[model samples]
Target: MEIKFEQKIPVLLEKAGKKGMTYKELSIKCKAKKEEGKYFRLAVQKCKAAGLILEKKGKFFATQSKGLYPAVIKRLHKTYGFAERLEQKDEVFILGSKLKGALAGDKVMIRLSKHTRGNLPEGEVISFIEAGEVEFTGIAHLTKGGPFITPDDIGNFDLRLEGSVKGVADGDKVTAKITKRGQGHRDLRAKVVKSFGQATRAAACCEAILNLNGVTPEFPPQVLEEAKFLAQRGIKHKELLNREDLRNEVIFTIDGADSKDLDDAISLSKYQDFYILGVHIADVSYYVREKTALDEEALRRGTSIYYANKVVPMLPKELSNGICSLNPDEERLAFSAIMTLSKDGKLLDYDFKKSVICSRVKGVYSEVNEIIAGTAGKEILAKYRDVLHVIPLMKELSDILHHNRKLRGAPDIDTAESKLILDENDRIVDIVPRQRGEAEEMIEEFMLTANEAAATLAKKLQIPFVYRVHEYPDGEKLNVLKETLQALGLPAREIKGNVPSKVLSDILDEAKGKPFYPIVSRQVLRSMAKAKYSETPIGHYGLALENYAHFTSPIRRYPDLTIHRILSDVVTQKRSASDIKKRYSEFVGRSANASTEAEISAMKVERDCEDCYKAEYMEDHVGESFDGMITSVTSFGFYVGLPNTVEGLVRIEALPEGQYQYDGLMELKETHTGNAFRVGDAIRVTCSGVDVNAGNIDFVPAEPESDENG
Candidate 1:
């Protein structure tokens, strides 16, 4: 197998890299036997499929289309779109009208727009490559000829029924699937795939929100059966062979009060001037092996989505919340990362092990916060008796680690989250800030250490691995970020070529305690590159880490599961270097690409759901006064973010009648009055209206306390 892979893949690419060759000529030049030539052909096909090579005129060659490449269209609103080219660091902008009716999230071929030659690259989407199945859920209305559906997405385009409708009527919530896309002036035609009850019901509305973003609540029968079988099989003694038995260890899991899909547990002890920290993650790979039905479904989900009211888990509950969950007093299989850190939190040494651990208690974050505060109630103290000494030590080490990262210039932009409270009727009753106390930060510190250790180990092994990498943000994003920094009182001279990550950290520090700090932090966060699973190591810019990967939550994230499978083979199974590389080289490339797209989709779904709930909540608060900060200023209007994380718009008309101009500094200025509304400005406003169907809110400025219409 080694010789076959090397000769066919590496050697073939190496030869073709020098010069192009036809299939017959390549085999003869490599001096391979007739049987080996067939293997060579298969290898070329794999590389081509994996996008490693390109073919033309019956000849094979290495892929070298470096500049101005085909990309998936990510439209910003309905007016314009952007695509980050494969070869360039900046994104190319395409006007929506020039898109020829291509919708957002569609894959299309784009090239630099005609007559474009400057630092900022402009592009035009010339053709639609694929529509991604483009299915949506919405209300279906009966017309004279047939049925039509109004989509629930941000897009307002309507679809006409392609066939005779059955089981669905006017105002019925239904899932419409696009079989073919419509061109300009033509209405989109679709088929009703599934039907819920009336679109007015909250259940149908919420379910439509999920379906609109392509999240299905149900899994395939095969995946469910596989999960059930794995749960019933149980952890056998043979499976526990060559694993550590840490059942007697005083370990515990700390998570949100309502969290049930637990996956990690912590154990801590002091060893002289060092601390022994053990982070044991559920061994999800043991049950959902590679190439299985369960694994396929998990890969498609990418990460477990934490919705407001429910969780759309990557793995079925039979595995995620059953045997794989680190429930208290249950002997569960886990992959342990045991590290010895100095008193100052520098990792001295570390080792990985496959183990069986039984957590003494599943401590909730709130209760643990009380324990850390030395204000534990009798019930809490009694419940945590087995590991009362461990909480303080965990806190100490966590503080050390947090300090260490701060010293390394890691940006501290961890924002407070809002916990939505709902009554029994599924109506939002209240929204409160879910503050992250010592317990939550402590777990985060430990998990970051373990993830870094995992990445470092995989790098040393020299095998293909998935790394959680955050590259430096570039192009127009950096330009606005500079303006934002200057807005935070940073000297314009401080913003220069290749702005260091520490600079962003310093800016965030300066903005702290200011009313605009949240929006500034949010804008900078948007300016930074999104962290994603990569097949290669790209130093994480945000965390200021050289090596990092998602290794803590395998039960929820697919990348962590992939890393665990590799760790099991390299560390425990002691596989050879070549064997590991050959087996996972293709996997690393394919899974990284697929998982990244899946994760982006899941995040969109979660965002849309939250927006829906917020709209529903504010439906009652219309005309009420509240304070909000302007998050962003655009040509049409400025967006205001409220305390509950709900954002809405105050249009340009609300300002003085003078023509408003958008400054390079990201402020909206009235040309005659010279008055401006800049980002991070707090203003009072009354909710004017709520477009629940579109998840939109309108805000009109409220009068000042001293002046009625100032």
Candidate 2:
């Protein structure tokens, strides 16, 4: 007279319907079997306790809801080469057999079975919970009857195009809109919305990347109109009348040689026993205002995106490059942070204000670096001599500030950056490494000082503001990194808890001058979480600062503009604490999410452009072997970076005439030969093929006997 646990599930599922049911239903569903009352109630209690059933509405139901077919769900571990089943209260399984065409990032519904003691839940994918295709960017390949688009980036599903849309010829890059999603057998349908010419590979790649990430560079027409109006009514003398005029101050802007949209300027002078450092940033919010088309558009875009060869500005060009730019010899409105510091880099006093300033000179980094190195050209040195006089002193002060930062646990990560040099035709001529010199460091140190000062002022005023926070690395990730480093014969201390920036800095310093330095440093950095803008005051672990915010480049960053507005309100004492708190809290929250998304989108476009350039660079060097470092380790293969900073994958199957095994904890090695290849290991690899269309580099390890033969 015992009621079985399996017998009640179907009856419960019928009651749950599409809305779903809860755990208590199981007892009621089995109540009709009179003599088995105790057993039925006990089974319900056991399932609830085991997290296999959810309790709702005095009913018992399976955790994954009751109506759908169940299959076990597992995450595809790309690095580990295995699917690890997920365990959670609401767990359901998606049967691999029922995956259909669903790719990663797709949400699916599944049914669950009775929980087995001490074993994983088994389920199958019954139905898709959501459809994922939003947009696609790729090249249109036209056939005689119709056109098909092959995706150039992620979201790999191809689309079929009709005759009208198939006007876009083969090799023509296009952005397509997802017209209809496929059900089971049919592929998703799309139509070409815009066609970019086939000649520009970098632009095509950028568009593809943006499409893949669900970001677009199109500006609203209303926003464009608003920008035009702002451009026409440029900053006037009347606007400067009531503001603190620092026009006569020796303020100057330093940027890249070809840079536009100058956002910040710096001035320094002696005031009694303190050095008065003025950091003036473009007051974008002043003109754009709140809730206007310009402001809303800026909020939507979040921040400017600077690709290698092009810039996708957050604001319209008329505003970002004209009115809001802190151009030399023009009176521009700005939100200024004036700090009084002692000779030893201690903050004594500070004032933030909305002011008007005129930049006396526009300096480029190369010119300043040459002048600081005492090897300036005559014309350049003459034009900037007055400003250049303080270059040496500023460099020394920057060194002092940098030293203090290191002592306080700031990481001096020496990651190299590369620049793409293009000719008049916009074709890349060379890939050059950009060195960090004293001039660059001097500017960076002062900018960091200004940003920290602004953040401190905002905190003291108890105003809500967006802070650029870098949290500590995850302990689990650090453990894996430590184990890998130890396997490479490197000393690694267990940093399994809250590791300070100083500890990471120490590790980085110790790894310098070694063959594995670059790879290890990159791996350690990868272990750390990404720095992001957030409303909450999470400390920045990378800089070892408690409060940090972006306050320098309002012309490029929306948060900086927001900071400018808050600082302006604080200086005027015009708003009550409660009002400021309420207004800025909402502003910071929205800006934080938007800025993070925009930053990620910008990086994608940048990296895509870099890959395009690298692919072009390798076109001429196919079949040549080069010495490289194994930069990344993955189950599928290892990525090797040549001296030019171009990375290619050496697949496990491509190992030199040996069966290779990937050790999860250590590295890759030959099964029979016992030869090992760890991350950061040096190896000579021959480039076998260059898939320019796919932006992939294929490499094969060079045999040792080939070296001897040569």
Candidate 3:
């Protein structure tokens, strides 16, 4: 009987597990004929490549290790692929061909591709695991042989269909289910699941984003039915018997003018030389009980995704915008955090309870900002007279909290984000920069206090819980920061050991008022580790807190919802029993993992949409020149950021003709003219083509045209 090389390796590897084998001994054990020695040797190599067997000191042994690990495909370099931001290790290196059709942000199971002498083990993707699940929206073509779908971006390979074409024509855009994979790139295919209208249209772009990210833009029928039923079912009178009645408290919610899915409200009271601050978060858990369709849907979503003109709400709007919302003058269910704090913002004590709160007013951030600025119109000031007196007190507390946070080494990296305004037709009307004002900051401070209070309580109880953690930056990154500072002619401060966040914060303060402050701030941010959900308390480095949990925004973030459920169980039950502890122990682990994954995925979706919106806005501005700063440098080119935060690349070839090389500081220097362009350098650039499908905006260097000439 003859076995193929692929088949022969598994048998040899299984046998090798019992005892280590030398190549000569393995050849003898294989019982292969002289002609099959090369084939047998090839089989051994295959086994090694798949990481099923390992050779140490010239003896082969079965690894007995399921080397499968989920890795993020960050970038594809020549002949090699890189897996970065992995939970298992710092990074996993992969052979390019062994990628098995993976792209950036794709989650995949990988094993060792090969282990060579004096080199780190490289990996190969064995399977593409679903982040949630894979579905691509793209344009499809009907060929004579069969119909195939091509993703709008990302995957360049056409997905061949097994059957006949559907309603989608040759040039039509469609969404599909990835039913099967071909052995090679050419054979990969999917079934046409749904069809959209045309490409580049408003609906088509939105549909493509939702499908590609595996985000359902609407709630399921059953989930909607549940929400509608609950909306009609008012809170039972008996349910309020034991709850704290805060209906008389001077409580109100502050949000954007157009906001409706309000989930948190704030109240304040005077208490002899101190202040009583109350943060009332919507009691979403009361309505969304465990195992229900509503609860399942919310967990699956993980978080809401907001776009230029749309929002994919985590919960059905009937609840998020209805009964669960803390609208003004309405009595609503809430999980309240009542804190007593001194004038200097020291939390003396806090109490948590299920409460019924009647909010006095619904305030807008813009109007409240006006009040703080002393520019509020008489009518606007009068409208908010009930809460106007407390606004100044809120600011006083906010300043104290902010000062204490800074003293504890938490830096406030305040950077403005872009807000793409869309017209009714979904076309980009304008792109504006949105900056947080006093009103927003005060609310943020109060919410942070509430979150901190809840986290402290959870830790005190010593129960299983998930904490939001931002770990300290590694030494190598601080070294890079040191280099960046040196390049900027700022002090290259040496970090002795595990440096405090204040050290970095001080460096950022030095960069203040500089033209490249944004670049420096952003680069430092990139050097820091991502904040994630963890079952264990490692402290939040960014917040400089020993304990922290997300107790706010339960209507949107699943982590907050999970926290609420835990608090409900622990507080209501009056003790963490064995059953409850075991249940939450499992929940803490599973939810942390799933929720972190979901949060990252949702962030990617948001970034992708932001890029799309930027491209849409820039499409009409071709040939227009604007002043921008060089924000990034790569071998291909450098990216320039406009004032509004839109970044476009200036390719190396487009630079003033010369051979440019990357300096030690990552600046591209021209050999002939000796002109050097590094990050933070201000340059003028003309608008270039916008590749919407690829989410790229290209720019060429030029001097801005004078207004008189125009």
Candidate 4:
């Protein structure tokens, strides 16, 4: 077989060694005719442009000789960018001049420079390998050279539009496709393809954000058809063959009152010292079979994104909220994990089975908490009368499990999560901190037990499966935590060296009920690594669990669905360990990676979209003074979070005219007045300004009472 000229040029150049060869000499070696000479020259040029071959003083050599590394542009700032080396730990900092028009997420080859900015190595882009995003969503402005777009992600740079943009007026949020690639930001050209309404509206900004993240509430026609068919089919009698029937059991689901995708349900029974806890998860894998349209779409989505009042589900509502949902009194297919645990919450033994269950009632968390608190109204009591006997047992088991978690030294780090209360017109009327009550914690503990059991079974069987893993925190972040604690005059003794979960737990315990408890909790959370899905069971640090997997919420989470798919073969099909491993070994790794990426994307979308909603709400509250605590301090400003979970930045300019020095972690001190504003400090601030499109809220000190130290 003859090699294509483009492919052959790189191989031939590489084989020529460090001595290199001239273009004319290479052409002669190929014995190219006059007509074929032009094609050979083109191949050489392509190879050189691709960073496969380098030309120095008319001599050609492979790029390896010059030590060019392939990297992905991780982030781009106004004047600089950082490229993370592929499959490597190091990141290269590229100045604006060295970037060579590379954008964030682009793959490129770079030549390392001798210079270094602190510990980061400096590099220059040599050649492009692949373009990351050809389209971007941003606010368009009418410039002298037609309309230009200022992208949401890329800062301070305007992308010039090619030709005239008809419908995209000034301040309209639009998505533009790159029409011409360039060697610099100034040369890049794009055309507006679509536009949301005015950028000033939070709704318009949110739509663009959702589009940019590839999140949609709409399902494809094929996936919808598949879901519709499965919903209509419902549960067939023949499909229940060889499955355990627990339809008569007093099992029920507990979720938010407005939640539609009810997936996991539970039942509890006390037998002397052991509690037979039944966790029945909606068997989504049965309906969303492998390689089907519904399954593919779910895998692509990975997890449902919930922002404000809306949700972008992983699966269609036909499955998520219809037949596959564990609705009250509905006989639904389920994967049941019946665990026999000691009264002290120790897992004695567990059984995983393909089962059918009829949830007796839809249990609301608030109502369950009221029952436990003896605060339930007559209506609430009557609603839960059927499963009222099991509520106390759940509370008892939850207390035992909570004690077990505390004993195992799992840090109880809590962050303030906001719930945007939207009006009928979808405008935010209030932003309140979402509180997790005892009922929520009980459900969480129950889910954790089932997840651990699932992972334990996979490990016991030695089968390939996805595990929810959270590795230990980085040593550098721990050091920062130690310094911050010491600076705050808190105990830093246990934060040294290899810190355990118990030490952090102790720190939080000491800080509990203190004015700075929120900041301490936030700092501890910041010091921990993010929990993600993995094929390898490395353990979860936050939960202090050795074995864990997402075995619940298969209706919304792809990782849970993946777990169900693998376990179905083991429990339902009764497949051998060897067979299961052979079938899913490679598939688990791919699923884990895809699930993690999708989860990250969903989280970003949720956070960004929620910020816009919050900003929109704050727009109506400008000029109002509110007492808030400093959650974090940056060089430019300190972020103040109100009790309602509304956070705004107190910019450095808003402070008294003085030089302010940032301690680099959480404190900002006015050099002149010796007044220090640190994380956890309380202050009264007035909402000064808000940029709804950018989701930025600005605050200023209120009156004479500005800074209040904790």
Candidate 5:
């Protein structure tokens, strides 16, 4: 019997390997064991019944192979607890379990149990794989019994303070590190590392954002010293001897009114029937050389971060805003793209060169817009007479290019508001709406034309380069969008198959004048995939083009700087194709990871600053009534966006005088009151109070108006 059982083991292993059997296959294999030699079958049945070997799909296999069990697992590695990976199964297995010990960005391995009759995969905790190294930033609360740390960020779970680190008092913002993990408990043990006062809002906010996004804000002291040395060395005109000289040309820069770090400038002239345009980008690679401390630090950062009131620059301030900045009247070094184009925005010929340029004028969008509108002020007219002469012509050419872009089905998103004015204390005072004026549009059109020309030239030259790519949206998400639009009585047929940008643009146009327009537009934008940097050209869906790259903004973006270095080497014949390919492949992989991390970090910081401002703004308006729109709907409650665009939750239990029942079919309808509230519905509410400590704004329904007619 023992021999027979041993002989059957190999057959079972082969069957399990072939069929991909889950645990249910073991029971069926046990029935087959009963049919073999009776005594041997009984012994095999006992082993199967003991659950030593399990079946997955249809075949039996040992549960423990290489001391690791076959268990389905999901890991969360982002601040939002987004699932990052699945092990052994295509499905996520931790949808309903209580994440007791897990933080927002923890990674845990799980084991799958038998599925119920109607349910899908059921998972149990296997082991904690990795704990994210995020230090909690908040005010420390002290009590006679013990101290506790309540985080400023709402999503974080609270931490229990140790006696040794309980020196921090209540209302003092502090940073704490987890000292011990609590199993099946609400709070984890932590030690306060630093206590900061109220004056540290900006610094603390920066730290919180960096921690949440898994980034380190401060550079190593060695990196800082290296940057200082590089800045001091600066760019020299002697180095420009081997490059093109574009100082004779009328090059100008157009940016925001408050911008200081000017990275790119433009010059244009009529060369016979075609127009010659020059795009002069600051030569960041010349200062930040390869394998150096500055380069290493810049590579880690990948891109500069612009928040509401501050900038976390990729390079040190001395370099970013001083030496490398293309300030007017300064002889700055540049990597230039000179392209000759026809009257219809078609590229005729182009050249990439490392060059020297002296910007003739520093232009801003508003001043240039006035010039284009034939309303230039006396100061502006005197300061930029050459730019004023070309403003009207540039507007005409830009309009033609914009029309061509529409003809090509490029997705043109609506102009969104950007934070403008800030108080002396770095709090948001006002939000200024940004309009796509003629000057801004002209710059954008010229930049796009230059980038496309450079990309096509790189491909023709067979040089390695990094291209910005945005793929098509996921089909599942498109389907969801289709269903949602149909329910909202909007045209959604064009969303199927290969969705053209025209269809999305048309939908956006039709949504105008409706209260739900912004919400719908935001949702449609979210359905699309994020743009990423890669060496291989996958095309850009947003631009509706076959090839696109970032040839501008080299001072702020690493990919553009890398492209500049590659172009410089190509033009000078200093590097071989093989070397370029090897370097580009390595940098592409690193750039992809670094760019993603940088973007995530920037987004977190931007949102954190916005939340801080929202809390500060609400501090003055407690108990005031305002109108709000439903922005999000969930099982527990719905999120409301006030007129100022700050969002807060409206808990279902707080709905006045009504028992709210969430109807899946209707999204959210209260059966008792027969009142429906879906996303985009407007309602009146009053602020209860601002929870500054937790960064939360609480609201309740406002009282109805009195009947003056009666």
Candidate 6:
């Protein structure tokens, strides 16, 4: 009979006691033949790799000894890496040589050593239980040994290609998959799986970015077929049995000039003491039912992503831009929130219902802003003739709401988003700041009112649902902000734990209209926690709202779709409270987690893609000088932002000759000259170099210059 080493090894080791047993003793206990010796040795290696046993002093033990901890590798640098403990928030620093073939995101067992780098604990990886899946996007180059890829994310070393480069040549942008993991960057091997034209072209680099982030433009055939079939079905009378017919209401959508996935519309009516604000969102759940292929795909994607002139929509255009879109003069299914607000913008009462609406016009933000300013052209006025009466009322309600938000201390931070202009050949020509108008604010206020109503309804009924939550900032981050403020000669408050939103709002209010407003706003934003979807209704800190849910834009947001689905059951009285909870408890948790992860992924993709386009545009203007402000300072360098929203790095080495040291807050100072570079300092910079493939722009001070303090 053959010994099952997998089952027998653990028991045998445990039976051998704490003293453990040597390899020869274990083989003897198993009664293995000469040929089986090799098999036994292989099984022991497998056991060790799986963390089932630990070997010390030539003896194997089934249980782990003291000081051994489980950790996940968080990041890998050229000479070192950091791994976070699985049981706590602490991190361990491991030198590249001690990584033991571990990669980022790998789960491994580590043993702490009597060493420390700064404040971090030092450790060495013992064994890896799992490998992380990471794809590398880079420019492929031919070397004497073979072909290698210089990754865009990491510049420490190149990844060696294991096989022949058949279709890929030098200077081509490519994506590679890991074929073999190694101890460090120098030994890792990968295989080229895709090639995207030349590396010099921003379009090709953008394509590689999409693949690297797993944002597929094309959908599965089954999902597309289902979407097409459902779209063709159209709106049937039987499906509108309990829905309210509001097709005559003067509802309209306001969006960008080129937006096609129209999701939300607004209508307002004035009363003596209160206003009836009707926010009707597209009923996407009517077509995308639970567990269907279309629903699965939307859930996987979570949200739509827009970059430059391109979009990776969560739903197929057949539904997003066709059936579920709220187009002008088209009767479409909608979920309406009829909110009654006081004259002072306080919510008095609300009702939600299934309805049908016909949009009066497709409103453009710029055109509406022009109309409000009385500068619109005759053609623009003629386009909005049907819904002209409601424009003033929209503005009135938005102003009142804005005042209310200010009173309640909601910090208004403008990050100044960038817009990229592309030529006929898909090459970027210019970069500029994206403009926002009053029409955008009006629409935003309406959406917030509707979202708050939805969450209040869910809380009143105590139902399981997904919520958009933003918690308070961490204490450590807040402390860092206080130190930075004091360093810049700004007011610093004494915060015990978590400070309220009003405190940060006051700081911003004081800094408004000043040259340092940008720097102050950036610091406040960095101190705030990120908003995410959750099954629990944690109030949003930034919005200063106790109740909030994403009830608008169902066509583009998965959380909004989920809210619509749950409200369907409540409004139709299809299920009792207990039944609803039993059916959706687990579902809500899963959707919230999946949606949060997908949203983060989509954000990264958009930011990275925008950087490549910006670099491409900057490539044409090299050596041109521009006046810019220092937006941020780091240990290695500082970043400068131009009026067009383009940012570039000015490394410490590029500055005037001096021994400079970082103040660890917001200033980089030189020891001998007493010169310093601080945030919000005005300086002249000349574009020195551009790396389109890596999305990097380098800048240096133009001609003779002195530090900000001088």
Question: Top lDDT: which candidate number?
Answer: 6
Q: List the residue pairs that clash in candidate 1.
A: none
TM-score, every prediction: 0.83, 0.84, 0.85, 0.92, 0.83, 0.91
Q: Write the per-residue lDDT of candidate 2 for residues 1-710, one digit (tens) a residue.
A: 33366456544655565455544444455554656667766765554443345545655455545544322223322111111223534443333344554434444545545643224455545455445544556778877767888755424345787537634667887877666665532366778877766724654555666655655677789998999988898877677776898888888888888788898888887756677788888888788788898888787777787766677788888878898888888888888888888888887888888789898888888888888887888999888966876666677678878988989988788776877777676666777677667778888988999999988888887789988999988877898778867877777685778888788888888889998888768867877889999987778999999989999987788888788777777777778888888778777888888888888777866777677767766767888889999887777789898777788998877876777778775478788989888787888998987755456788888755545656
lDDT of 3 by residue, 180-299 (tens): 655544555678777765554444666677776679988889999999999999788998887999898788999988888999898887777898999999999899988999988888
Q: Rate the local accuracy (lDDT) of all candidates.
A: 0.79, 0.73, 0.80, 0.87, 0.69, 0.88
Error of 1 at 107 (Å): 8.0
lDDT of 4 by residue, 193-290 (tens): 78998987777888888887788879999999998998888888997886899989999999998999999999999999999999999999889898
Off by over 4 Å in 1: 1-134, 143-146, 152-159, 162-173, 178-183, 196-206, 704-710
Q: Which lDDT tens digits does candidate 5 get at residues 1-710?
A: 54556455535655556444543354355344444556554555554443344434454555344122333223432122223333344443443234445654455544555652223454545455456665667777777767887765423445678747534556677777777776732457778877754523544545555554545657788888987887788766589798788887788899988888899898877766777778888888888888888888888787887766677778887778877888899888888888877888777788888888898888999888888787887998998987665666667667878988888877677635545467876665665455668888889998898788767877776667788888888776777677667767887576876788777767777788888877767767876888887777889888888889888887777877777778777888888887877767677667766766676667766776666656666767888888988766776778788755677777777776666776432257777778877877888988877655445677777789789998
In terms of TM-score, how similar is model 2 to the real structure? 0.84
lDDT of 5: 0.69
Deviation from native of the Cα of residue 601 in model 1, angstroms: 1.6
Q: What is the full ranking by lDDT, best candidate first?
A: 6, 4, 3, 1, 2, 5
lDDT, model 6, position 484:
69
Better candidate number, 5 or 6, judged by lDDT: 6
lDDT tens digits, residue span 147-255, model 6: 8888765336788887778988798999987888666567788889899988988889989999877889999999999999988989998877778989988899999
On residues 1-710, what C-alpha lDDT tens digit does candidate 1 reach at each position? Answer: 22464345545645556467787776666566766666666766665544445566787665443222446655444455566554344677766565666665665656675554345567776555456556667789998866788766424556778876878878988887776656641345778888876764444566776776667778899999999998999999887777998999999999998888999999999978989999999999889899998988888888888767788888999988998999999999999999999988999899999999999999999999999898989999999999988988898899999999888988899575767778887777776777889999999999999999999999988889999899887757777777787775765636545677888788788888878788778877887888888999987988889999999998888999999999999767678889999899999877888778888988887776666667777888998989888888888889998887778889888765788998756689888888888887888888888865556788988866686576
Q: Stretches of candidate 3 above 4 Å error?
A: 1-137, 141-149, 152-166, 169-173, 176-183, 187-191, 574-579, 703-710
RMSD of 5: 7.7
For residue 461, what is the lDDT in candidate 1? 81
Pairs that collide, model 6: none
